[model samples]
Target: MKVTIDQDKCCAAGTCVLVAPDVFDQRDDDGIVILLNERPPAELHAAVREAADVCPGAAISVSEDA
Candidate 1:
């Protein structure tokens, strides 16, 4: 799976980070969503999807690899 985040749309809720710290993170200064892994390993796909689903700001985007 591929992950992407829109900083402009982020509300700094930190849900993504909590759900998938390996795939997402927060900037210490403002707690904005940060994309830690653009293309995470297969083992992390589930968490990445969960993060995208629960993102309050809808800042997380995921694309599955064919």
Candidate 2:
């Protein structure tokens, strides 16, 4: 799976980080969503999806590899 985040839409909720720290993070200064892994491993797909689903700002986007 592929992951992307929109900094402008981010609310700094940190939910993505909580759900998938390996795939996402936050800037220490403002807590904006950070994309740690643009294309995470297959094992991390589930958590990445959860993070995307729960993002309050709808900043997370995921695309499955074809």
Candidate 3:
């Protein structure tokens, strides 16, 4: 899977960080999401998907690799 975050739409809710720290983080200054691993390992896929779905700002985007 591939992941991306739109900082402009981000609300800094930190849900993504909470759900999958390995795949996402927050900016120190503004608390915006900082994507750490654009392509997370298979074991972490569920958590990554959850992070995207539960993001309050809807800034997380997950796309399957074709």
TM-score on alpha carbons, each prediction: 0.94, 0.95, 0.95
Report residue 8 deviation for candidate 2 (angstroms): 0.4
Question: Distance from true position, residue 28, model 1, in Å?
Answer: 0.8
Error of 3 at 44 (Å): 0.7
* Best-to-worst lDDT order: 3, 2, 1
List the RMSD of every prediction in angstroms: 0.9, 0.8, 0.8
TM-score of model 1 (CA atoms): 0.94
Model 2: per-residue Cα lDDT over 1-66, one tens digit each: 778889999999998889899988889999998898899998999999999999999999999974
Candidate 2, residue 33: the lDDT equals 84
Select the stronger candidate by TM-score from 1 and 2: 2
In model 1, pairs of residues that clash are: none
Residue 48, model 3, lDDT? 93
Candidate 1 C-alpha lDDT tens digits along 1-66? 778789999999999888899888899999998798898999999999998899888999898865
Span of ten consecutive residues with least summed lDDT in model 1:
57-66
The positional error of residue 36 in candidate 2, measured at the CA in angstroms, is 0.8
> Between the candidate structures 1 and 3, which one is better when assessed by TM-score?
3
Worst 10 residues of 3 by lDDT: 57-66
C-alpha positional error of residue 9 in candidate 1 after TM-score superposition, expressed in Å: 0.7
